[model samples]
Target chain A: MTGAPRRTIAIVGGGASGVILAAHLMKVSGGNVRASVIERDPRIGRGIAYSTELPEHRLNVAASRMSAFTEDPSHLLSWFRNKYPEARDEPGRFLQRREYGQYLADVFAAAAASASGSGGLVHIKAECASIVQVPGGLELRLSNGTSLASQIAILATGHDPGPHPDRGFASAGASVPPIDCDRRVVILGSGLSMIDAWLTLQARGHRGEIVAVSRRGLLPLPHGEHRNPIKLDRADIPFGTELSYFVRWFSDLIDEREAAGGDWRDVIDGIRPFNQQIWRDWPISAKRRFLSHAKAWWDVHRHRIAPDVHARAHEAIADGKLRLIAGKVSDIADRGNRTADLVVRLRRSGDRIALQDVSVLDCTGIIRDPATGSNPLISSLITAGMARTDPLRIGLDVTPDCAIVNFRGEPSDRLFAIGPLTRGTFFEIDAVPEIREQCQRLAVGLVG
Target chain B: MLTKKGKYGLKALVHLSRLPAGQLAFVGDIARANNIPKKFLDAILAELRNAGFVQSRKGKEGGYRLARSPSEIKVGHIVRVLDGPLAPIPCASRTRYEPCDDCDEATCQVRHMMLEVRHAIAEVLDNRSLAEMRDTTNDDLDLPQLQQA
Candidate 1:
């Protein structure tokens, strides 16, 4: 508790980013910073990722790495024990993401209640339609026809599953189109999103045939215990090299490590800290090459899921209820029928697999193009020339410190972004460990 | 086969074709808007500029704009500019023909078959203009998925 809080930071979404940032800001500023979390969704902490009611949907990361505070490593496990004492609280335990959501909301509440300074949390249940810079700060227009003023605005609007065409196809597809529990369902993209759909369907007692189609037919690897991240000097890395050369170097390193009685996971975990730096050092051409050629491979290796989830997917495959195809859905035809027809073109064999009279679920991926994403706030930011998509269209363009860059490539002072929205700038972000550290750093900067 | 470069070029052209006449768009904006690589798009736009498809200006407001009316530019023409010929084989190409090292010029079965393949591809592509491509919505593409069934 310090002097009277004069500044209020308006966080546009009440997801993990908004809550975590609010907590960090309060902690760093000694409760001298004020923030209002504006979330259109009813829940204050769930966001899109953690809103699931299904017990089967758990966090991909373990409890040990899911702490909200950088200073407290055991915070998540402690909170989990208090909230659900019957459940196991092992460090490696993967708790339900919904519980994590509850933990976040509770943390923010506790911080706000105990703060002696004017720092408090106010959750506004309205969508931020747009944000514009004012003379001294920023103005936010909400969907409820109300406006908000704050010293700074952070766009914490989390993952969008692309445009409206992708409606009913989000990975957390609870309210999707009606489909028989025993009918065939074809899911596009065999990545995390596909795994999510598989988990959701299995939770719903779905016993039908599920065909997963992807460019490479790759699945996410599972998490394990033995984590030995290697330390590397800056000079040792082939910084600013062509993508192929970097890939070759990494491949050789992996081979050498595996030959020396080590696991490939060690190599991936070893390079985790340097992933963003390596990406930053590359030229636009090299970055493009990585995205086009190595992104899928990298994604599977880096973003591993829970071991139980991996086992269930494989079990389904063994039971012949799930099918994996190394192909792409070239077209989805809806003849005003209940089921859409998908013509999947196999990549290797070049054979067309005609999936007839099956429900089509597009779990292709996250919102790659932020400018055209489903969120009106993002498009409004772009239209107002206050923000722009990154060169890759992966997310909103941001400076390394998470400042939103305008159309002319100028980073804003009062306007900022975090969470998955800043993925283009911080490639290794979106996970708890990375985002938590980022929030702490950003909170320090804002408070200072 | 349309290379990724060609797809990107088409996407860029489609984006440009949608812009109001004489209105300019920076290469970076176009690249981000259409999910195209910046350097690759820069090169493609330069080729398009040289082919009289787009015009570039200099200065702060400098960027690119469609030179000819989108309707005046055919899809086949842009593909040829960005991705060589529409024909499967060089010998079958009408504008940029080159003899294949293995195939005969006359009465070659492969060339004859490829000539028909080239004609079939050109018949559709040459008829469609950039304007048509621009007008084709994602929903319109969905219709063919049913027609082929």
Candidate 2:
């Protein structure tokens, strides 16, 4: 085993996923692997999800489950508490997402500096425009007008935001004009992004009316205290049924669990481990049914907000400052004067309401259609017959082992996917706990 | 955008429209008859109940029935409640109007064309009651678009 050739692994995206994967590869391969993280952002681990400088944006999950390594669940909590001693008292604190992003980058850097083959890891700050399969490895063309070779290239491209407007909208985590504080804000979607933007306004001392609208008008439930979530057995989950049957069964389970003195959060967290399995077991029809009929409800219940943020949001509502509308936005006519008229169709009363003179924020979150993930590199790959979208078009098509599937229906061992890009294959993989586990598993396989 | 929820809700409403006057049908029966998912129908029916299109009773003998006669309920209203509007774009709808940002509200040809389309659809749907929707044959209807939806 001495002096064996070092294997090169290229991760195209230096968000939390790529940073975590790089750290895991270094730890697993000892001194025999070289990994490169390609990203346009000079700041590592601050991908689209985490680059938010806003102090209000926080981790959706609790501190206990947010470790970089699945084996060491308490690493993040310990690190956070050590950094901010005030956090020692709050065991379930949902820290600012920026803090978590910084922690991951710190850990990744530390791992690289202390590794036996410390020089093997490199962070290349450039965009990976395209990749091609070479004879014995892979070749990645960068936007900086250069190319590099690697034995394995994993698309850690992070969360694809889909098609977005050039401007005229405020988004969560993004900095807006410093003094637009007193303007009425009309948020398009009432999901987590809406909360982030609202909180940012609050932090900036905004006192204008904020109206948030969505089709269902559902706000994410707040995270609650929990000990051990109730464990679910494989037999208990109704697999291989139509989504309707599964939904009904799950609804009944919720009732029963509540009646028996169990928190609904327990039921959700209990089924956490099996989400991917359940997603896989369902037929394509069932999958489509769930996406169309039940995804919103599942998202609200599964992805909850921090308790403090929840209380503040409600307080704003009670103060008559924040208004939530359950309806649809029909049109936004820009008056060409910074203010726009947002026409909304009310779902409850079939009424058309126009919200005028309001600054707009499209907080609808990720684009509903995964087919819109046709970025330059992904588009090039599809055009070159290298990779394709999954059947449901949620994300990249991948095998059970996370290998990318090409247009000819062949899984390429050297090309892989992780994080949100692999969501079609592993439905619950967007969160930190699941992504860490994916990185660990893939690192082991890559090292082997 | 006719979502699955809207499609299922429409089918369920149609199923209720065909029932004997004052007759109540269990959710399972509605699901089976219409081939709708029982779980999905459960939510759709609950929404319909809130909208006062259907009233559900609690007991084992109790079930769901239309809150009003099929003739009194407009298909357009049902679609508006479940989906949103008949207009392909929001700026074009009579019931839900908004202007596109890039085009002038008074002069956009696309919005005008879409307004005509909305009028054409509303003429059929708003005028046609749930009874009419149920009575109409599927032959002349452009149903493939609905299936794709």
Candidate 3:
């Protein structure tokens, strides 16, 4: 190891968050610190979402909003133009995800180049397997059986695949193979992920029927045209401590927005900037109190769908290619060769039990329960008492600055986290704006 | 659906895996055998070569061979080398964790929780090698587990 007094930082998981963080640190550090990216895969950037080769896999967000660095918001748009000049006419359009992945890779390449040319090395190791926090810093185990020692480490792990369902009946499910392409698939959730799965099945030429089941069966709201906008007057909305009161206020606000000719997406998007603050400022008891009753509705309102994607989903629904069922799954019986029969309980009806044959796909969104996380590092950290799960158990609890809090209610000096995993702490962590804000703040604190 | 690149790359790799060691297979042969576009497969091969997953011998009898033994190389390695990190989010990614500059990874609750996801993904990719992917199985009962899962 090179002996130097310089601070060496090791970053794990080279996804969007990691790459952006690295880029920001290099820009902000101005060659004072050394940063190394330890990626388990041989690829340095281009995480799963952007690595698609399908041109139809457009990003959910517009190209104008996907710059790697927050300060240079137009960077991605400019890059897009240079890469695909034919799409110059549409500025706010969702570009293909493959193009976005290339853009991110190019951004990281430039950052690494700048850091290297400046004599501040930005080492991007292709394979980092495990990391252990040490006395002075952190030690990362590489796939090649080597270890890198650094003073600080950041964990930017990316998205988790959906959860696996429990054991069920053999006869109840006979139409869908566990992962068959032609099976009558029953998607467990009705969100963006479910849309992706449905689209994927269609792309694969799977002609079988698709069923999306959720408790509410509430499909995502579509992005509306920027016509007659519904502007909410927050002045009249009385602040209330009770969950029912807040729900009543929100429902009324929704009604007003729709009446004003503005789509619900507009109302939700308009409130997003202040959403986290509202969650933070609200009494913790009230916030926890809302989880049981109002949270599901809140999620549907907040995470809207792309207009084109929504239209496609609606077309599928209208054509009967897709079915939306509002019910809780009671049991699933494996039939044979990727087929299953399921028992469903309607949420509204008291005693209506429906039995049907379908394939089940768990598109329940990224696994929220950190307790069920299959990562050894996280399990070790929790067992060693370095981190504590939040009251909701969706994720770990951290202090405002994002330091992981231990069971005794103390923040760890050595440990840190970021990204969608903080859903319990921050309601709006998945979007680009919040992530950019987060990357900026975290880089500053680390450099400072 | 896996991307065209991934699908083609996997097919090409599987085809390569079945061939005798050190024997060069032509790009045309790989493309024709797999029914992948010759032009697209060429580009993918170039990437695989540059990424050190494939070694090509350019000549009349030349095609491509595994840079490493089939058992040693992982499908994840080829995908990642040709593509990028397995996970998209910083928190779920196993290898690269540059804390978003705007937030403190140490103090950020979101990042902390994502660490679990990142490790889980990293563990799967890191543990599984190409050699494992090339092992052929006729067991129809073998649920082709998306090992990445």
Candidate 4:
């Protein structure tokens, strides 16, 4: 350890990633570090994903896969068994998002309790408005007119759910309440958020027809019992391969599996552990191609919903209550009577189809670029030249260790980022499994 | 979530659900009608039969038949038998209850949401019988269709 006083690390955003990072830091720091978590919300752990008021929004991943600690993979599962004894034998279950949030809060609480006498963990219920580099540390200015100086700062603000991308649709102002139950609705994205909106509407007793439109309009696949534990060694992956070649290779592999009566999921799941490596090995152009061409397809297959949820979604489609349209919404116009029509260009024919009397819901997931976002903290950092967006513009630029890369192309030693803020560098940073591993590594690096 | 087995099984069961009560449908015919591979459909039907959703007989004129009336069998029940549980998460599952290991069941935010998801799913799948979904044409809309490009 350094021959200095205890180092203070300020983590902005007390979400899942921040909580997990603090817990790991407490375990490894050995009273050498004091951690202060700055959050806008009153409570920590329930980020945007888990803080939903609706109960119908379930986690896409199963229970067994959502452990906050990679070392104790069964931490969540064991907790579940202890709480719900009946489910002790069933490991392949998905829990509620809030339950996961509570678990995180509990884990953080335990960690904080243990570190009470040491450097200790402090929770500051305030938003970090800006961070400035100072001598031997950084100063974090909070929204509550307070400031804190720390030896290191970790940006874990997570993703921002920005407004709708289509200016015309957003201007239509269809999101207002007293929603017409009979009006036709068009959702702009076919991801999990789209499904959430559909479920929300259903819960609200909406009998209207819904048309979910996306560039690909590919809905998420259903989660089924995984029979095969297919293991792929590094040699099996086409590392350093071009994007086109890798796609062909992967397609052929899926074809081979299907031919042998095996599910394609086995292959996708098998390669999950190695995605970061493959993604890292890919050339810049290859990564771009992947983001442009294969992202939608990969999303649907990789992010599967529970079987019953799948059934309900399919049933809605089957009943003609919901429709999946593969297209891009070109424009939306309000038609004077609180109704609007969207001009959608079909993906295949490029023919414009006018969807009539429909309200549009923006479910295109969270914003990727923090620089252009409404988040004051992110905007402040970008403006101060303390952080810069990656070339892809998907997220902030960060080194593999999550050190913030400045505009001068230098990685900051005292400043770091984790979670969704580092998506541009690590493609799979949003999910619990990936984030937990990243947090563990970052904690070790920071403490060491 | 519908597994390939569950989907194929549901399709076959729906096909049977549409048939005259007590009449049998051959595995080949069901597979051909639904675009499911014959071998795959055979295994799926075998599972459905083992779960007591269907009864099969061998030899000429022998085929598979629903064990009960189509209206009596809920899609949710079939899905649970073929797939596993209707609940998105284990803790919210009624038929297969399993507590998550990480949080307080009473205070977990995720369980509350999942419970609602399970209820929504159960409302749709459990309340609607196979007979009710038998005539729905949207079932095959996901199948590949020619599009003008």
Candidate 5:
């Protein structure tokens, strides 16, 4: 062990994906790699999703399937069992989001401790302001006025909290205090985040009527009893360049499954394993068509809610406590006294409905268009020509291995993007299972 | 969460639950009446029998019957026996309580929310016996309605 300098990798964003990559790197490299995780937040491991303290914000995926390591599928389950021996063995149970965050913290801590011999994992609690390619490697300008140079850098920044509505509502302003219970609340975009907002309101004992509006006004389907698992081969999917043919094939598959007394979820889950491959194979036009047409339908089915949560949501809808409207918010007017009036164009009729005196929460999922996002680092990278958006303007363009492609359309060997930032390259890369698998492979590739 | 096996098992049990006391129903009859595959129903009944929810008799009078009177058997027990647990998350299960790892049990909002769900489900499945469900005749177990007063 005379004098060889170990290769150092810098991970920006100490979120779930970032920590997972660090943990896997330490494990695979066996303390031979130097790792530094730079995060803006004081807490590492808890990303925007898992950082929530709200118990109502349960994991969308079941505990049995949420292991951090792909090799040890039951790692999380075992952790739960060891920690909470009395916790019942519910195969489909959705654990609290914070608990999962803690589990990740534990994993990171363990990996960091074991890798202490070889430079160890450095937890830099500072935001990376910009990343620039230097002669030997890359240098990261951190927000805390310190800079770090590494042989390689990874961007695991996760999702951006979408762009604000063009016409800002009064409640969208920073000065607006916590929403009062009696004030009518209107949530824009009916997706998982919208559901989280609803759950939050319900948990907070908000008594006002809640209205969630989206383009299609579709609520996620509730998770039912686990059915027989369906496996699909590449041949089973209508692999083609034509979007229409694929859509027809998918529709027929769902119909057949339903006719055969199988749930539509079986078909969706079966296709999930192949989503990225299919997305990669599609022509740009086909991809655009799917995004405009089928993305919403796919989202609601793919991201289902727990049955109990679904029952409460259904009850709320039935009781008129929650109203889901299929429409577009054409305009929002900020009235004085923390209230906003919104004009919603009904989807079916094209007629506009004026919703007066409501608090609007923008839960429109993630901001896919990186150019319009509020992240300074991402903006800086784009401006510096270090990173470029995909053709669809959804996310950063990268090769299959997630090496960020520069303005010149060449994949960078030293710069990598993981998690939601690489969504354009891997369609289903956001979830824990997908991200974990990607990190495992990425760690091996980096070290080897 | 009810598994497919649990759903099929419940459907078969409901068929048998509707039978008059001392009467027995064959797997084929239950399968045909419920639109469940015969082989599936057979396995479901075998599971029920093993779980002590039902008792089977062999020979010319071969069939299955609830171990206890249908009025005394709760849907929750059958579901728990077949489907695993009534909790959407394991932390909320009263019968099988395991504190979630890294969770603050006292303050966990998820567990708190799920506990309500577990109770809601138990209220319907545990409170309503097989006899009551069989007597309803509507076939659609109005669970959401059942939660209402």
Candidate 6:
């Protein structure tokens, strides 16, 4: 009945992007494309990022802006109403991360159901262990020994945990699992993950001195009150390509946003959609230069806590429950009892520096080897020479359109990637807004 | 960025609604028009089918058609069918309603306020059909320009 049969697609990792990709593919194929989503965990959409059971952990972005689709920006807001029917007026409300997880699950389920009804069938296997390229498409090996051959594979595996730095801390002797413990836990990094760690610690009744120490020891700023009703204008600001120029330009832009009756936070949120374009616009040298010199400052300013979390963190600091310290870890020598003796160069009081000895916790956060994904499909593709890490070592090598670039620097015709894993190629890829766009584009590529 | 279900549900449905009865448009054609990725759109259309919104025809000259008229398919229904609840906060949601864990629902002042907001949001999302969204002018929903200081 047909000259060539339609090829099935296998999407590895059923996180937000993976599920979104599957759902989009089903729609684009008009139920003609056979597809399957392979996730290591039983829960498809609730990956490590959003799998938290805590209600206090909230989405970083506002619900109004976090629609599943850009065109239908109100979709998420709509869903929120049908479920809660209580918090609808609060546009700036932050929701429990666990509930968001449920929302994601619902989306995935709907997509799978739709696929089945269309005769296209979307199978979600909870145990795909490895993926290797076959002659026509891909050979996916599941943990249960079953395999599926498909024409296209999309790596939508989400972010891996942060890396564990080498040092005496690596030796797990007497080291209390940094999380859910009652100790004077001194976290080494002050980022969102550290905040998460802090929240978890506090929630678990860790009453000891919780010091979040870093080079600058800067705690993320709290979400400021929404001051400006005016949208930010981008046309007047000419984005410079050099790191120095970009920094200056961004600083000026912050001033501009403030002048428009908003804070730098508003400016950052306003530019969220254009971040990819801005990253792409810059030369690789500039992007790399940013990572080395400016990333820390940029991150502190960019990723902020919800106001409620920020207040809690601040109160903890004021009450001596948590201490934020700025210093350099000169050395982390091995000490007995799973603790490391840290030599720190504390910022000078009045231009005179002092050295302090403190026991430290490596709350540096989850380290995922970005060069490779934890998913079996990504691991297999890399081993098979179908994909390689980016030159910058930020993430996997992929084209702007999200195609996987092999060791030979060739974009795979049948394989693609998206979500946090593609951050190397697209700097703004970590957030949902960017990934949703990528999912849409990647789905179009599959059919086109 | 709309999730594949959010965008493609409207996309494939739009294409199918425009076509004559029994004539199905392939996923590729609809995706190109809507700028949705093919793979993601595929899953989204499948969702529409399962929700009893669309029907598919396999083999040659086969694709998908709407199960009901565009007028009958509300945008919120598709969203609920695909994305679950529209509200992000529990107190605002209608279908999966449970009071925030820390507070009592009956006496919670915040919960009562949110309920009103939820009703307003539902009025718009649940009532507006895909046919109406398709007909809406771009200018009607044009993104506000970033104002310069």
How would you encode candidate 3's per-residue C-alpha lDDT over A327-425 as one tens digit per residue?
Answer: 888877777554477787887884455546666666666645676575555556678677777877767787767778887999866566777666677
TM-score of chain A of 5: 0.95
Relative to the unseen true structure, what is the C-alpha lDDT of residue A416 in candidate 1, on a scale of 0 to 100? 91
Clashing pairs in 2: none
| Interface C-alpha RMSD after superposing true interface residues, each candidate, one decimal | 20.7, 18.8, 24.0, 19.8, 21.0, 20.1
Candidate 3 structure quality by residue, lDDT tens digits, B2-36: 36897798889888878888777899999999999
Cα lDDT tens digits for candidate 5, A236-329: 3433234665676678778877897898888888788778877875656667888889889989998888888889998999999999999998
**How far out, in Å, is residue A264 in model 2?**
1.1
RMSD of each: 18.9, 18.9, 28.5, 20.9, 20.2, 19.8
TM-score (chain B) for candidate 1 is: 0.83
Q: In model 1, which runs have C-alpha deviations exceeding 4 angstroms?
A: A1-5, A162-178, A335-338, B1-149
Alpha-carbon runs more than 4 Å astray in model 2:
A85-89, A116-119, A165-179, A334-339, A367-371, B1-149
DockQ category of candidate 2: incorrect
Question: What are the per-residue Cα lDDT tens digits for candidate 1 across B1-149?
Answer: 67888899999989988888999999999999988889999999887776557889999989999876787677876776677658677777633457878756886998888778877776777678889988876686788787799
lDDT (C-alpha, whole model) for all candidates: 0.80, 0.79, 0.67, 0.80, 0.81, 0.69
Cα RMSD for predicted model 5: 20.2
Per-residue lDDT of model 1, residues A9-65, tens digit only: 998888898888888888887666778889988778888778877788888887888
Q: Could you give me the TM-score of model 5 versus the true structure?
A: 0.72
Q: Give per-residue lDDT, candidate 5, residue B143.
A: 59
> Relative to the unseen true structure, what is the C-alpha lDDT of residue A28 in candidate 5, on a scale of 0 to 100?
84
Question: Proportion of native contacts in model 3?
Answer: 0.00
Model 3 earns a TM-score of 0.67
Q: Compose the digit string of candidate 2's lDDT tens values, residues A337-415.
A: 4468888999999899988878777677664334445368877887788888898877888987899999999999899
